[model samples]
Target: MENTKQQKTNVSSKTRTLVSAALFAGIICITIAYFLHIPIGGNGGFVHVGDAFIYLAAVLLPTPYAACSATIGAGMADILTGSANWALATIIIKPILVLFFTNKSKKIINTRNVCAAIIAGIVGTVLYMIAEGIMYGSFVSAFVLSLVGLVQPIGSFIVFVVIGLVFDKLKIKEMIK
Candidate 1:
């Protein structure tokens, strides 16, 4: 009975460690994305850094945790940047983007996944554009926002693929609890 109790404690501790690691990695990736966003519109038009990080988190962490982290991290960044008004959108969009991949976990991460990521990125970007475009009207310009959506995903895909490759090489996934 004593040994069984000790074993339970050890399992609990390991679970805590895994959760902490996932949260830490998520925050760090969010921070990286936060710094990457370029301010464009006077209100808050920008490219998100969290895109790659969200994608990475989804691939590595559990679906729920990955989605939570992506939403919280991106939303926090929006608030920090004085785009507090758009926090809801950031929170909503990031998780949905993360969920896109999480829902299809059976599929291997490869060229096809990359293409899907690209599509999701563009779709998310366009959603943001439409939201802001409504407020800014014709003056804000969808052309630039559209370009950002198109380009950022390609950049994000490259980043995620490289990170995934590194994890494969280092056998990090084997360490996941």
Candidate 2:
């Protein structure tokens, strides 16, 4: 019983440490993304650093941690740019993808994982498109919306794949465990 209690306490402490690290790392990435905004597709946004953090969180952290990291990370940029509405959708969607898709004990960043990540990104983008289109009619056409959703995921996949390769070569995969 004492050993079990000690083990539980260690797990709890480790979880807390990872969660705090993710939160802080998320904030840092979001700040950099804000300063270096790169727009893609009609409504899709892009960033170099944001993906690194998201992919890392998805690979290393649990669902809740990944979700919180994505929400706070990307949402921070959206909030700062006076786009509170966009921030809200990002907070909901990005983390859901990271969490749901990365549930198994699998590395979340790799060539194969990038393919899975691409599919997940499309799902996330489509979700945002549907929600935003319904609320604001921001999409000029359904076709355009479809294209935007597809293109962004493809772009993200390509970018993250490259980043994943770099990280893999550098043996960052070990860090995720």
Candidate 3:
């Protein structure tokens, strides 16, 4: 009887943890995406720091939770900002970004993670540019204009490094244990 109760409790605790992580991470992602951004390149597109949170989610949380949060948050941000047209692209691209760099056992700045981050950034930028090219009916402006959006991925990596260090310094994983 006691063993059964303990097993149930463990499952409940894990469920709660996953649910809370998803909700909080999603909220943070959406808020960052919608409320914070920099316009550039004489085009209507903007660069936003929401990817920082997406990367953080991938680094710190389980992959499914992180992927869902990133997709939902960025997609919702697009909808709320009247760029609903980009929501589908965001949902697809952001999850791929998270999946590529996620390595819970590795340090964020390690050779593996850094290489992965650079690749992820390139993938993200290229995918977004492709989406924009399709939307704009001109590949040239989309490519040229979206180049500035690279700042977001670069900035995201920097912020990820800072947050990753802080989380490491604080022994954040131990807190869960």
Using lDDT as the measure, which candidate wins?
A: 3
Task: Write candidate 3's Cα lDDT for 1-177 as tens digits.
Answer: 999999999999889768866775666556555645766664446788778777767766777877887888888777776668778888899889888765466454556666667788889999999988887788898888767788888987787778778877887656644
Candidate 1, superposed: residue stretches over 4 Å from native: 2-14, 17-34, 102-108, 138-140
Better of 1 and 2 by lDDT: 1
Better of 1 and 3 by TM-score: 3
Model 1 Cα RMSD, Å?
3.6
For candidate 2, the TM-score is: 0.70
Model 3 TM-score on a 0 to 1 scale: 0.86
Per-residue alpha-carbon lDDT of candidate 1 for residues 1-177, written as tens digits (9 for 90 to 100):
999999999999768756754674557445534657766656675665557777767766667777777777777777777788777777777778866665244333656557767877877877787767766675257656666556566777777777767776776656653
Clashing pairs in 2: none
All candidates: TM-score:
0.77, 0.70, 0.86
Off by over 4 Å in 3: 41-44, 106-109
**Residue 172's C-alpha lDDT in candidate 2?**
60
Worst 10-residue lDDT window for candidate 1 reads 102-111
lDDT of each: 0.68, 0.62, 0.75
Worst 10 residues of 2 by lDDT: 40-49
Best candidate according to TM-score: 3
